[model samples]
Target: METIRYGPEPSQLAELTRPSGRPKGVVVVIHGGFWRSRYDLSLGRPLAASLAAEGWAAWNVEYRRVGNGGGWPGTFDDIAAAIDALADVDDLDTGSVLTLGHSAGGHLAVWAAGRARLAGPPWGRPRVAVTGAVSQAGVLDLAAAHDANLGTGAVQDFMGGSRDDRYRLADPAAMIPLDVPVRCIHGTEDDVVPLSQSTGYVERAVRAGADAELTEVAGDHFVLIDPASAAWARTLQILTALG
Candidate 1:
């Protein structure tokens, strides 16, 4: 694993794990911790290592969380920089970049994929585009999550306040028809994040003519991130098929 800095900030870094042979593509692994500072990039390390073993260059990214220097556009900016930084990595196949994010990271993964749709946004244009995405029990619907208070006001904290006009740009659910294929995998028994997050997002995406689908497995929220769990195995299969 090689550590690279996309920005001068301590959190504006990412760990790159490359396969021995030429990589099929790059997979940006974004961790999920309700977008809080307590949850760092470690949550993505295992998935990054696993992707490397499967012949994909894994870019495990770290961005400022709420408690840190991240909130609203700041967090979004870091994600954009980290992904665009892939352009500087030699021998990496930037043509087919995909995203794998769990929970809050899942939201970022899908949101980053749709950055192309944002017009005159604060994050700016995307260089390395996302071709596909896999959301592991992600908080796809910001409004729904906010209304339910799923993360105990996590959505509010992430947005930095109540759901306002900014939600049109910030919420993954609102940024539908991502144009790229997306597969949302959720645990049926997920207590941390309801299964509806993925299901509702997929439903909206499909209705909007995007290639999206939902898969439900039996496990809690964390099972999807556990490499040893069947849920993770299924996630790997989904990612392999997408790749």
Candidate 2:
């Protein structure tokens, strides 16, 4: 694994793992912890290594969480910068970049995929485009998640309080029909993040003529990220098929 700095902040960096030879593509592994500082990038290391073993380059990213220097635009800024930073890395085929994120990270993954649809700073003109995405029990609908308070006010905290028009830019559910493909994987018994999050988003996306689908597996929220779990196996299969 190699450490690359996209910005001066300690958290504004990524850990990159490469396959033994040329990689088939790059997968950005985003971790989940309700977008809090306590949950760091270490959560993504296992997935990164696993992707490398499968002959794909994995970019495990870290960004400022709420307790740190992240929230609203700051967190969004870090994600965009981290992905754009890949342009500087050699021997990488950024053209086919994809994202695999769990929980809060899942929201960010889908959100990032629709960056180009947004119109301005913190949201538009992505330097690196997301070709595809996989959301593992993500909090996809910001408005819905806010109302349900799924993360115990996590959505409010991440968005820095109440919803407004600008938030439409942040909600993946609102930004349907993304140019890239999106696959949502949710655990049937996930209570941490309700299965409806993925199901609802996919339903809305399909209605909007977007390339989206959902797959339900047996287990809880964390099972999807466990490298050894059958859920993860299904995830790998989807990733391969998507590519």
Candidate 3:
């Protein structure tokens, strides 16, 4: 595992793990902590390592979260920079990059994939081209999350405001019909992020003519990120199928 810095800030770092032999592709892992500073990139280390062992170059990225110089546009900016930084890496297959995010990270992953259409002063344009994305129990629908007050109003806190233009621009559901294929996997028993988030988003994406699908598993939220969990194995299968 090699720690690479995408920006000067400590939060703008990613752990890169190369496969034992030639990598099949690159997998960008994004951790979920409800977009808070209390949670760091460590949550994604296990998944990155697992992907590396499976012959895929995994890049586990970290970004500024709420309460750590992160809110609204800052958090978005950090994610954009971290993903785009992949262009600087060597010997990695940039053409076939896939992003996997859990929880709030799942939101960012889908959002990052659709950054090309984001409109606002803060969101310019993302240079990284994501070929595919997987959201594991992702908080994909910001408006619904805000209404339901998931994570004690985490959506409001991350957006730094209520449902407004900024919230709409940052929302993965609102930015649907992304060019790439999106697969949303959620545990039916997930209490943290409900199944509606995945189903709702995929419904909208399909209506918008995007290639989106929802896969339901039998587990909870954390199981999606646990390397030893059956959910994790299913996730691996999904990633393998992405090729």
lDDT digits (tens) for residues 73-115 of candidate 3? 8888888888889999987768888989999999998988888
TM-score versus the correct structure, for each prediction: 0.98, 0.98, 0.96
Candidate 1: C-alpha lDDT: 0.91
- Over 56-79, each residue of candidate 1 has an lDDT whose tens digit, in order, gives 999999999999989898999999
Badly placed stretches (over 4 Å) of model 1 are: none
Measured by lDDT, the strongest candidate is: 2
lDDT of 1 at 189: 90
Q: Least lDDT summed over 10 consecutive residues: which range in candidate 3?
A: 118-127
Candidate 1, poorest ten consecutive residues by summed lDDT: 120-129
lDDT for model 2 comes to 0.92
Error of 2 at 166 (Å): 2.3
**Which residue pairs in candidate 1 collide?**
none
How should the candidates be ordered by lDDT, best one leading? 2, 1, 3
Instruction: Please give the lDDT score at residue 62 for candidate 3.
Output: 92
Give the 10-residue window scoring lowest on summed lDDT in candidate 2.
Answer: 120-129
